[model samples]
Target chain A: MTGGAVADNPGRLYVNDKKAPESLRDLRKIEEALQGNLGRAREATVGIELGEGGAGSGVIVSEDGLVLTAAHVSGGVGDDLVIITADGERHDAISLGLVASTDAAMVRIKEGGPFPFVEIDADDTARLGDWVFSLGHSGGYDDARGVVVRLGRIVRVADVTIQSDCKLIGGDSGGPLFDMNGRLIGIHSRVGASLEQNMHVPIREFHRNWDKMLASEFIGEGPFAKKPEPAKAYLGVAAEAREEGGVEVTRVLEDTAAAEAGLETGDVILEIDGEEIEDMENFLEVLKGMEPGDKIELTVLRDGEDKTIEVELGER
Target chain B: MEKTRQSKSSWASARGLLTAAALGAMASVSPAQQLEGPYRLNGSAVLQAFEPLREVLQSSSAVLLDDWKSFAYGLVVSPDGYVLTKASELADRDEMAISIGASKFTDVEVLATDVEWDVALLKVDAENLTPVVWKDGEEVTIGSWVVSNGSTSRSRRRARVGIISANAREIKGSSNVVLGIVLKTEKDQIVVEDVKEDTGAAEAGLQSGDVIVEAEGKKMEKREDLLDLLGDKEPGDILKVRVDRDGEEMDFEVELMERHRVFDGPQSRNDAMSGRFSGRRENFPRVIQHDIMLSERSVGGPLLDLEGRCVGMNIARANRSETFAIPAAEVQAVLERLLEDSR
Candidate 1:
């Protein structure tokens, strides 16, 4: 992360060059701009360990030890965590809160310090094709390796997320994404369909919800947590809605209530609990109101014969 | 205690829960433009930044085309239309064609193919082709700007720029050779468990329960030790194996084949797409890893420096964060061998 510093000429957009560097000096200037911010940002970026789970990357955003990370990495508000800095120093930290919808989270070092931090560019002025650098503990913490830096372009910028061509992997989540000026622009969110398709949470969103995060106001469930759904009675049969007004069982999951009830593929479900099952949607709607262990009589059509079978539902 | 720990990370309020209906509705909503302008450029600024490199590449790079599809990109290595490209893409084609700009030549001949390095040399019946000049031993320090240029599927020139993330190093791949011998631990020594019939081990006179002492002069104390010795050896490679049979040490030459070739419908395509999309394959070897965003098809083209000098040839689009390229020196060495083979 050590490199020579370049002169900071404010108001000069680093990406104004519409062509490749014309000379070695131009190339040196480009290198210097990346190095200057990268050297400082690497120190501010830390590795977050969530006990038994895998590690993630985070950036110290405030001098008083406020750290920003992906909500998925933080897990939940008040979660005890350990943060490892670039120098491999471990610090105790607690998750403050998360904006689950946007996958943004904040944490604070329990032991306060004038920590090295990167300023978040509140304007979020990152445009398409602007040069950006990403630093993270890619492939987790390799003691032999220092903070990894990847230079790429802002592939896309939107209201909710900024997509970049920068390659990110599992351990890179919650890492800092900085513009060419070395300002924090986004937080690494998730990898898209391809390596070039990476998503980041715009720093502007983080600034907008700064107070709520500091107040420990938790938003939706953390990234890894499945959103809580209403308990549904599980017949455990893969079915398709037949055009002729019934749910056709395509496959029955083994060891499930449907399998135990002698449900087989090709069996058309006509009704449940004396309620006519019009289609797959209706069948699902009826089950939503029921719970596991609920006994219901199912009318099924098999080989041109209609038979009612008693079935005990399982929890899903 | 486990339940309490699990609950700590769970949502405390039901209001935040997303019902199945709600989840379905969210999916139905059009995903906010993940990309704008051309899907490839991501933005107009990217187009502008790449214009210069794209202009240089369009003149010096060619599209390797088959009868039906554009398979790969080729870098003009010589003035008289000698091109270099990835061998795998050109391996199974019925015919080879080279496309420079809008002009297409069908009378292209495969000069040589180096399977070990996954590069192919081709000679096109053309003249006045712009050859790319090498930077020549240019040390690509980490964080230096690098640009990858190649022919897109639309036959248009494209370029992606990034920094050198790592120096050149050997990145190992998983598709290794199979000696066809199962080794077992016996009395702190690696013993031959079973040598399948018609395999290199059986052909080399290896028998069940034979204690393996060394392979290719590397002493084997355990099963892992023998595996390490055979890790780098490929199929058809002659291995000088020494084994102890009934207190008698005997050396025998054994040939190695790929492990999966012993059985199976098809050897797993250890191709980049298998790894790039699934993120499950092993890494390549001896590559200069960079952050340039080039697709698998775009590989085999030249990675140019800011001064339009060929720094390397894009070899593998490793993953989301790293692309591998064969350095100029290595590419030059391969091109030399290819020329010799063609002669």
Candidate 2:
């Protein structure tokens, strides 16, 4: 890889030695680890059907069929559901305790005992870049299709959610996310526009509220808790286009980034982080890419003088 | 050998710092992480790990280009320029060129095509190209790690990693929403020329010579207006359809049915949220579904397993998360039949 045709292709970098599996031997070891746990993973995974045609997935954690699924998938407390196992057998079940804030919920199969189950990662040991796999009934379960499996690595682990590149879709919500060792680490909750924006409810959230959930209590604020829907960055300023050049700020909301940054109603925003703001529309286009808590430098014209102000955006 | 080993170890440690910096940027929490951007699994940093598998995989892969832009990727099946690609994607075979191993060949001939399998065989004016080594499909089980390789925007071959997401089985096409009516245009008026038997249109007593006046309260003046309304509707959806039969306005409730049961055509909607997918995605005899993100242009390339062995040729990009590949055994059978037919 040092000196070959790779050099001919400009703007390309091919480094053979790095963090990912560098050789065939390394890749095979990863493959073996995934294969060893696959059978157990499949047996414990189940498809969930909300009576009104909504579908999801869950994993059996206990021998008595205590299942962990997404709070949204669980719906209202005591809502009856049909649980379909990997073998295509359907069983009766009902929603149990739900933690709406973190999108964690529990369910119990009514009839059967000694059901197949996977172990949970009680230690919350999932680290960034740890190899993980997700299992669910993608596009809902088809007898011939069986349960679907997706492989990815932990990209980001927040307090309530874990993000991965294991591309998820509709009907995959509430599916089980497991480490290479088959330990349940998270449950699928929501998917964003891209392939990597898959968010899951970390198992630690379930563990923290396990006792409350087992008691069939709605833990997070109410039955329909406001789950963390990634918020956009807010500047908290109303701007009107001015014929001269930049837009003039008409109003500044109280306790917002703009007010905190000493922006007045008459101040004209000239630029954002050195980029010229043509008008209100251009300023909004720049703000669309910004995230909450992002600190930006705003150049404004006040009293015929330009001033630079630093502001930390707030969540909308 | 010792010097090379030392440099390799140093590069590994340097990359480790780069990986840490990226994670730190996300962990800071002040700046929201770009969730849509590349992550650990699909990022370019991860591609460095596939360098060892690149030479062999890239050499055997071929790309089909139209007007200097690649439209499909092909697998070199024989040393003497015998290649295979998705048949339906080649809309105009005469205008396409085959690019393999730094050589672009325009003197390409279509040998044979299997319509049901969507496989096509091509003969190019080149020789001694590396062909892909086949692996048994039985070895490809669910949850197994598989990698797909094809030409990137720079025309450089790159690989993406994923897992076998589902069982290797037949994907029935046309499981999509439909109105079950053969429409025709008569002087700017949308007319139902024929309604299929046992369909929602026929059940609602919609007959030929009926001019469709409105659907779901939206006025239908042309064939496109009715199509636009039907596009937004789903199967099992009951819509109020108003038609004029001999100047008499009457309303009937019509329920949409599956496309396969009503007609033989492509699926109705391409999930806009998932991005562009192959127009001819479904109805494969057998497919090994995986979650590797393959663009429509990247389809028809080689799908390799962890051991850097070819397990299949990517047949279609279904959606953002799903890509379908024809098994190696099945591909070989198609090649044999195509060769026989060409002879």
Specify the highest-lDDT model's number: 2
Query: Scored by CA lDDT, what does every candidate get?
Result: 0.70, 0.75
DockQ of 1: 0.09
**Residues B48-80, candidate 2, lDDT per residue (tens digit)?**
666755665668888888877889999999999
Docking level for model 2: incorrect
lDDT of 2 by residue, A42-122 (tens): 889998876434567899998878899887777745557889988888998877668865678888776665799999887
Q: By summed lDDT, which 10 consecutive residues of candidate 1 chain A come out lowest?
A: A1-10
In model 2, pairs of residues that clash are none
List DockQ, one per candidate, in order: 0.09, 0.12
Q: Per-candidate TM vs. native?
A: 0.63, 0.67
Model 1: share of native contacts present? 0.18
Which residue segments of model 2 deviate by more than 4 Å?
Answer: A1-18, A222-316, B1-39, B92-94, B150-155, B174-270
For every candidate, give the share of true A-B contacts it also has. Answer: 0.18, 0.30
Query: What TM-score would you report for chain A in candidate 2?
Result: 0.65
